[model samples]
Target chain A: MVGGGQLARMTHEAGIPLGIRFKLLSDTPQDSAAQVVNDVVVGDYRDLDTLREFARGCDVITFDHEHVPTEHLRALEADGIPVRPGPDALVHAHDKGVMRARLDAIGVPCPRHRIVSDPADAVAFAAEAGGFPVILKTVRGGYDGKGVWVVRSEDEAAEPFRAGVPVLAEEKVDFVRELAANVVRSPSGQAVSYPVVESQQVNGVCDTVIAPAPNLPEELAGQAQELALRIAEELGVVGHLAVELFETADGRILVNELAMRPHNSGHWTQDGAMTSQFANHVRAVLDLPLGDPRPRVKWTVMANVLGGDYPDMYQGYLHCMARDPQLKIHMYGKDVKPGRKVGHVNTYGDDLDDVRERARHAADYLRGTITE
Target chain B: MVGGGQLARMTHEAGIPLGIRFKLLSDTPQDSAAQVVNDVVVGDYRDLDTLREFARGCDVITFDHEHVPTEHLRALEADGIPVRPGPDALVHAHDKGVMRARLDAIGVPCPRHRIVSDPADAVAFAAEAGGFPVILKTVRGGYDGKGVWVVRSEDEAAEPFRAGVPVLAEEKVDFVRELAANVVRSPSGQAVSYPVVESQQVNGVCDTVIAPAPNLPEELAGQAQELALRIAEELGVVGHLAVELFETADGRILVNELAMRPHNSGHWTQDGAMTSQFANHVRAVLDLPLGDPRPRVKWTVMANVLGGDYPDMYQGYLHCMARDPQLKIHMYGKDVKPGRKVGHVNTYGDDLDDVRERARHAADYLRGTITE
Candidate 1:
């Protein structure tokens, strides 16, 4: 695995039961996954020499993020290393413009969008689509609300261009709720799609996710899964692929974004589904038959625990654990910093409201946002 | 932790989510837990200097096994190091004579037993209890099927005495099956008891465990839980405690043995219970509130994956995972060796028979005991 963030931390954990010896190329020894994984190389993933050395003796090289340079991945593949979710598919996640163009070409439903060279082009594109209040995003190096902006005027649209990166403008989605369809694929063409989930975002960061997208019509849910599976098959993705979507009030779903690695929206699967996204990713990359994606319980809610002023979340565990004994808390081994995702909590049960409340409360308490 | 084995490996995993910093005193870098835990001291656990240095920064010292010398534990306790399941309680697990005597004093039922100075003494005790076919066990350092014998005569009984350890003899009860009651206790007096489970032993090693003990009368199950809880309270145990019991054909339960750490019989709890035994043990030792011990499903079966001729168990994961997508497999990072406990698999569902077969099949496949 390349990159030693929380996703890798969790993937390392999921691989333990499968007897997978993970060899991580981390930027530092303090990276979340590096703290646990036994075999780790602290080096730059972008360096060809570092990547070559790290891939040695590794069965298949998968990723924890899509930030590795496309040329470097192709280089590894040229050296006979199996880079899962090969560069061809990974490029889509690396650049929003490419993803939108590819999805548009495939007739995948997406908001009216166009790559813009300058502020005037963005304005013209927005005018052709709808009007003001358009979404402007940098085509690369964006995550967790960064490199994204809501532009209501030409002046606001010019902000993203200052970074000297390719920008794209799309008509702002008028959605009732955000949904995600997550799936895993293998090189052998095996694929499994998880239930569509409703994701609640706070300040553009994923806050909580409700599996099966509560109250969603069965046909629409099926359509979402089908779309995700088709995308995985069409793109030849050989690992987890999360399709973030927007469900408009008009009863239509539009593709929002894509992540080639485990995404926050599917965190609920760690406790809710028969097989977790992390575990399935390991299986898929190894070309092992994928496990079931069915939900184990009727409802499941996962809430992210952002780092808070309380440096020691362990102290809050006494209250949270006693209050909700069924809550499954997962923490990334990281220092607390305001607004950083440090952990998450999963709650599942027969009742959606009860499960949601338990998950939310535990996350809040751990983040020190709630005292009671 | 005082030892670096599979229990420690699992306990270390459970502690990760709680933000617990585990400092392990492992005998070698190759020990199961040592392979994962970052803060490890490779030293002899019996050496006072080594133990003292290991416990310096640790908030509380706990164990993966009860074999730590009683004097070493006392020395640490005297130095103001908090040793959970203190020597007073751990001594019971360390010596069979002490445990049997203490249980007898507290009115806990047990088979006819006596501490024998030599082979003649063992013979006289067996004659007084019933006849031939008595169980002889060493007072300390015994695990699995080691240090135990089925003595039919004086000659056979002399085997254990050669080790120069204290020997105890007991009438071998003709039991219909074996059961285990596992519980966790916090220093604050909070405790939770898991469902009584039926454990099947092959060559005195735990082969499989069925949670809730299929076909067990509710009354007997309740009695077993109550007895386990009482034992924890009476012993002042501040961590996981497993009460091994024999359910005789006459419809009575007799205490067989006690383990102060997580036992093989409770392995099913990793996936079946609301909170796993390893997690609860960590919480109990940390003096945190205990989590719920309720089963997540109606039934769960855990089957140990004993090492077989196959060296690479990972090759078999593809079949086992695809065949039973819901099976939860846990592997200890250990080399394959005949009859060694390499891992275990957990299967839980509403149907006991279905769950049992799935667990057994996965375990057997991983062990290479069964193919196709």
Candidate 2:
């Protein structure tokens, strides 16, 4: 795996029981996955030579993030190392412009979007998209709400174009809620989709996810899954593909974005799904048969534990475990940095409200957002 | 962790999500836990200086096995490296004679037995118990039916003493089936117990385990749990204690043996129980609050995959996973050897027969004991 973030850390954990030997290419020894995985090469994923050195003797190459240059990945593939979700597929996740164009060409439902040449072009696209209030995003290298702006005027749109990368102007849909449909596919074409989940975000960063998307029409849930599976097939994705969607106020779903690796929206599956996304990603990258993706309970809620006033989340375990013995708390082994995603807490039971409260309480307590 | 094996491997995996850093003491790099844990000191655990070196920067010392010398544990404690299930408690698990005496004094029901000085003394005790057939065992270091014998004659009785260990003689009680009650306790005295499980052994090696021990009388199950908890307290054990019991033909349960760490009988908890034995064991060792130990389903069946003609179990995943998507397979990273436990499979649902069959089929298929 390239990149030693929490996703790689979790994927490595899932691989342990399967007897998989993990070799990681990380930026530093202190990286989340590097602290746990035995064989770690401290290097740059951006450098082609570093990537080639990392791929030697590895059965396949996968990622914790999609920041690796598309050309670097193609070179690795040419060197005979199997790069899952190969360069062609990964580009759809790495670049917003490419993703919007591909989804549109495939007749997939998506917000009105276009690659803008400059701030003037962005304003023109916004005008074409029905005037003000547009979402402007850098075509490449944006995550966790960074490099993204909600532009209400031409002056506000110039910031994105100034990043010196192609800017994508998209209509900001008035959606009732955000939902994610996570699917995993193998090289042999075996695929499995998890239940569509309702994702709640604060400041464009995910805060909580409710599995099965509460109050959703059953048919709509099935449609979201079919859409994700179709996307995976059309894109030739050979690992986890998280399709972020917008459930409009008018009762319609539109593609919001795509993530070709494990995403925050699927973290709830760690405790709730029969097979976690991390496990399925490992299986997919290895070209092994995928495991079941059914929810294990009636409801499961996951709330992100963002770093806050508390520097160490370990102190929260005492009260949290004592209060909710059934709660599953997963920490990223990263030092606490305020507002950073340090971990997540999962709660599940028959009652959705109770599960949600339990998850939220634990997450809040860990984040020091609540004391009691 | 002081030993490198599947137990250690699973424990390390459990600690991963908790962001717990693990340093292992192993005999070789190829050991199961050593392959995954980043910091592993290759040295003999029996050597006091090597152990002292390993314990230098550790938070606490724990084990994957009980072979670590009791005195060495005491020395580590003297060095201020807290050894969970401290030396005093570990001695009970290390030596059967001490365990029997302790249990008898505590009024815990166990088989009638005593230490025999010689073959004549064994025969005398056999005659005293109105039986020629009796069980003879080495007072210490017996596991998986090793160092134990069912002796029907004086010649057979003499074999155990020749090994130069004190022999413990006991009446061979005819039992209906084997069961195990697992419990975990923290140093602060917090304790949790998993549902008692029915264990099936072939050739004295665990073959299958059914969680909640189907058909067990409710009160009797509670009594077994209470007994196990009482034992953990009595011995001052600070980690997992698996009390092996015999459900006799007369409808009474008797203590058979005890293990101080994660045992085979509790393996079902990995997929069945809300808090796995491995996770709980880690929590207990770290002196953290214990998590819930409740069954997540109606029943879960676990079947061991012993090494047979199949050398690599990887080939079995496609067939097993395709046939039963819900099957949870956990494989130890070990080279296959005849009759060696290489992995296990867990299947769970509302149907007992279906669950058991699925687990058994996957395990057998993995072992190459069955095809199609």
Candidate 3:
């Protein structure tokens, strides 16, 4: 795997029982995945030579993140290195403009938007989208609300253009809430979809995810799953795909974003599903038969533990375990920086309200330790 | 961990999510835990200097197996390293005579037994404990039916004395079935118990396990759990303790064996319980609060995949996964040797028959590949 972040770390953990060698290509020795994996190459994923060196003796290459230069991936493919979610499919996840254009061509429901070459083009597109308060995003390199802006006027529009990357102007659709449809697809065209989940984001970073999206209309949930499956098939995605969606007040879902690897929305599966997303992602990448994606309980809620210096994480971990005997806490081995995701906690049971509350309390208690 | 076997491998995997560094001490680089852990020291665990080096910089030390020399553990403690299941608590697990004597003093239910000095002593023991066909076991270094024998006569009894180790003689109870009560205890006395499980042996090696032991009398199950918990507390066992028991024809359970780390009987907990034995073992060794040990499903069956050269494990893995998507396969990264345990599969559901069948089919299909 390329990029040694928490996703790679968790995925590697899932693969351990499969008895496979997980060779990680990390940018530094201190990277999250590098802290755990046995055979890790400390090299640059952006440099083609570094990537090629890392690919040696590896059966297939996957990712922890999608920031590797697309052209570098294509080069690896040229050398006959198998890259799941090949460069062509991964490009859709890398560039917002490319993703919107492809979704439009494929007849997928998406917000109104267009690639704007300059601030004036952005203003004109915003006028066509809605009058003001439009969402402007850089076509590439944006995550967790970075490189994204809500432009209320021409002056605000100019700020997005300064990013240098092409700007994609989008109508800020008034939606009831955010939802994510996570699916795993194999190179052999086999696929499995997890239940659609309600995602609550705090300042554009995922805060909590409730599996099966409480009280969601059955028909809409089915449609959402089907649409995400269709997107994976259309994009030729061969690993995990997380489709971010906007659930409008009118009971419809629209494509908002796409992540080509395991996403926070599917974190609940670690303790709640018949097979977790990380396990399925490993299976899918290896072109092995995927496991069941059905939820094992009536409800599962995962809440991110954003860093507050991770003050005495062991103390917080002890408190949570003592308080909630059934809670599943997953901490990434990272130098916890304030405002950055450091870990997550999962709670599941027959009662949705109780599960949600338990998850929230654990995450809050752990995060509160930092400030204390 | 002091030994790099599958128990350590799985325990280390559980520790990753807690963001704790797992350092392994293995006899070779190819040891199961060493193959996966990043900070692995390849050395002989029997060598005091090597063990001292491995224990340096480690906060707490635990075990994958009970074979580490008792004196070496004492030395580590003398050096200020916290040895969970400290030497005093671990000696009973390492020597059968010690275990029998300790249990006798504690009023634990066990078989008629004694330390036989020689074949003459064995004959005398057999005559006193219901005549011939008694069980003779070496006082130490025995596992998986090794160093144990059912001697029907004096000639058969002479074989056990040739090992040059003290022999323990006991009555061979006619049992209805085998069962195990697994529990975890922390340094602070916190403890949790998993449901009793039925264990089946093929050629004296554990072949299958069924959680909650089908058709078990509720009162008997509770008694078994209380017995195991009492054993853990009395012995000051600060990690997992698996009490192997025999259900006699008279409708009573008796202590058969004792294991100080993760045991085959508790493997079903990986996919069947709210908290896995490996996770609890990690938590206990670290003196962290124990998680709930309740079963999440109505039934769960685990079948061991013993090796016959492990013919194309990937093919068997694919077939099993495709056949039963809910099956959880855990393979210890070991070189396949005939009759050696390579991996195991777990299946769980509301139906006991279906769950057992699925688990058996997956394990059989994987095992059949070796012979084919």
DockQ of each: 0.64, 0.83, 0.86
**Deviation in Å, model 1, residue B257 alpha carbon:** 0.7
Task: Give each prediction's root-mean-square deviation over alpha carbons.
Answer: 1.4, 1.0, 1.4
lDDT for residue B331 in candidate 2, whole number 0-100: 90
Note the residue pairs that clash in candidate 2: none
- Candidate 1 residue B43 Cα shift, in angstroms, is 2.2
lDDT tens per residue, model 2, A47-99:
99999999999999999999999999999999999999899999999999889
- lDDT, candidates in the order shown: 0.91, 0.93, 0.92
Say which prediction, candidate 1 or candidate 3, comes out ahead on DockQ. 3
Model 3, position B64: C-alpha lDDT score: 91
- Model 3 TM-score is 0.98
Better DockQ candidate (1, 2): 2
Candidate 3 residue-wise lDDT, A155-242, digit = tens: 8788888767888889999999999999999999999999999999989899999998988999999999999999999999999999
Q: Write the per-residue lDDT of candidate 2 for residues B22-89, one digit (tens) a residue.
A: 99999999998888988889999989999999999999999999999899998999999999989999
Clashing residue pairs, candidate 1?
Answer: none
Per-prediction tally of clashes: 0, 0, 0
lDDT (10s digit) by residue, model 1, range A64-173:
99899999999999999999999999999999998998898889999999888898888898889878889999999999999999998888887999999999888998
Best by DockQ: 3
- Model 1 lDDT, full chain set: 0.91
